[model samples]
Target: MADTSPSEAGNAPLDQMGLDNFAPYLMNRIMGRYNAALSAEMAALGLTTPQMRSLAVLSVTDGILIRELAVYAVVQQSTLSRALDALVRDGLVRRETDATDSRATRVYLT
Candidate 1:
């Protein structure tokens, strides 16, 4: 195989950006385009990116609490609640209390 020449390697600052850089940048570019399309397709279904994320998390995990959703959604509790509210209003999700811990509320995809 041909070797990587000195300058064949990217500039130092770019290399310093490294794998961490590529993953988010590339993922964001792809997701941005995909989200644009998804937004239009799912608009009639009343779903937004945040709402879809919440539903996916609840569906996969199957009964995580609101606090856990906040973590999974990578947002503040208030933000997750607002997202969940829209989803619940749209009939895509339901929240139930944990009998063992009245303070805990688990969310599930309806």
Candidate 2:
């Protein structure tokens, strides 16, 4: 009555596959371990992984539009917004309206 082929089933069930066999899961696990190791150092500086990434990118690029920053930082605008908000509040980063484009907002490290 219903298709039950491998293609129709989409991804294999998690229980059927070893955790190491899933790329997404493996990447997440790797990042989780790295983040865990970095947690103490990050906490001392009052930064999360995303916030650290945002700052790191800004530090290299200096001034970049929020959209561009999101690209380099590998985060969605909505997600980057939270990190930017904290950085702005902490005085670690600054935001200025773009002179040529009213709708574009540029961010820079302080």
Candidate 3:
């Protein structure tokens, strides 16, 4: 096996690498704080992160397909499916079979 020590690899150790210098770390920290601040407001409205994300995406792009919505909302297809079910049940959104492709479903805000 090849040695991957920091001196041999010419890479700084994680502790030596400042957190701000890491884009993903910074983004995760920011999002964590944002979510913590928003959680209570969302809960009061009976929404989870995935549900809120779905509504945010649907607001701008109504009638988007379920698979596409999952990508745009950054949620898993199965998780979005459950969220959509709740949204539909609460009358916040509706789903209709796609006219062109009967197998596909499109979502719309109500």
Candidate 4:
């Protein structure tokens, strides 16, 4: 008989552990493959996933606040700041302080 134990099957069946049987483990492998292809394509464009996402968000919202852009870009605030700074230096993006709130910065595409 074929062994069904973890040592032989690699991972225990979710049903055995009483967890949801959605087969998330296999889905993770599929996602990894997809990400690898996506990263390669983005790299050819001189952009990382985060940078690409930022550009996509900017295209949709021509002038969005920096904080809101960060959320849409799906990057950490500090990481987004560095990415935005690079985009600004490259003449692809610019920042402007809100007239009503000097502390807040709005980002615009160039």
Q: Per-model C-alpha lDDT, please?
A: 0.79, 0.88, 0.93, 0.82
Ranking by TM-score: 3, 4, 2, 1
Per-residue lDDT over 35-100 for candidate 4, one digit per residue giving the tens place of the 0 to 100 score: 789889989987777777888999999788889998887789899988888888888889999788
Model 4, position 57, has a per-residue lDDT of: 96
Clash count in backbone of candidate 3: 0
lDDT by residue for model 1 (29-94), tens? 898998899878777777766777777687789789899887886668887888888888878788
Least accurate stretch of 10 residues (summed lDDT) in model 2? 5-14
lDDT of 3 by residue, 1-110 (tens): 88688846756676777787777899999999998878778999889989999999999999999999999999999999999999999999999999999999999999
- Measured with C-alpha atoms, the lDDT of residue 86 in candidate 2 is 93
Q: Judging by lDDT against the true structure, name the best candidate.
A: 3
lDDT of candidate 2 over 18-71, digit per residue (tens): 687888999999988987988779889889877988988988998899999999
Off by over 4 Å in 4: 1-31
What's the lDDT for residue 95 in model 3?
A: 98
Residue 26 of model 2, lDDT score? 93
Question: How many angstroms is residue 58 displaced in model 4 relative to the true structure, after the best TM-score fit?
Answer: 0.8
Model 4 lDDT at residue 96: 96
- TM-score, one value per model: 0.67, 0.69, 0.84, 0.71
Most TM-score-accurate candidate:
3
Per-candidate RMSD vs. true structure?
5.6, 4.1, 3.4, 7.5
Q: Show model 1 residue runs off by greater than 4 Å.
A: 1-11, 15-23
